[model samples]
Target: MLLKYKYKLKPHKSQSVIISNWLEIARKQYNYRLAERLNWFEATRTPVNACPLNVSVVPVEGIYQNIPEFR
Candidate 1:
């Protein structure tokens, strides 16, 4: 016979706050990467190759400064 178990997490106040912050950061990164892929596709009309993500033609001065450098 086989048995399965499931558990639910109940975080405290501080832990919940930390989790929220981490989730927010992850959401921002996801959006930024998605935009990068779309922009690349629009400009080249081709799929991305083995090129590094840091080789973006877009500027990072104003709006994208918060994104961590992958290089």
Candidate 2:
């Protein structure tokens, strides 16, 4: 047998707004990186319709054609 618990939060308006902004920033960041990686793959004929769940999503060739050393 197993048990699980769920919790709900009722943050204040200001806090909720802050949280929403942070989430939006994170989502945008993720999409930006995803696009960068997908576009970098030139050799693969397979299309990237969505983010791959496979561990081998990035080939041995690697993603990011011009990843900045500082970034």
- C-alpha lDDT values of all predictions: 0.83, 0.78
Error of 1 at 14 (Å): 0.3
TM-score of each: 0.58, 0.57
Model 2, 23-50: lDDT tens digits are 9999999999998877766534355686
Worst 10 residues of 2 by lDDT: 43-52
> Which one wins on lDDT?
1
Model 2: residue 55 alpha-carbon error in angstroms: 21
Which segments of candidate 1 are over 4 A away from where they belong?
46-71
Query: How do the residues 1-71 of candidate 1 rate in per-residue lDDT, one tens digit apiece?
Result: 99999999899999999999999999999999999989887875534565556555666686678878897
Estimate the TM-score for candidate 1: 0.58
Model 1: residue 17 alpha-carbon error in angstroms:
0.2
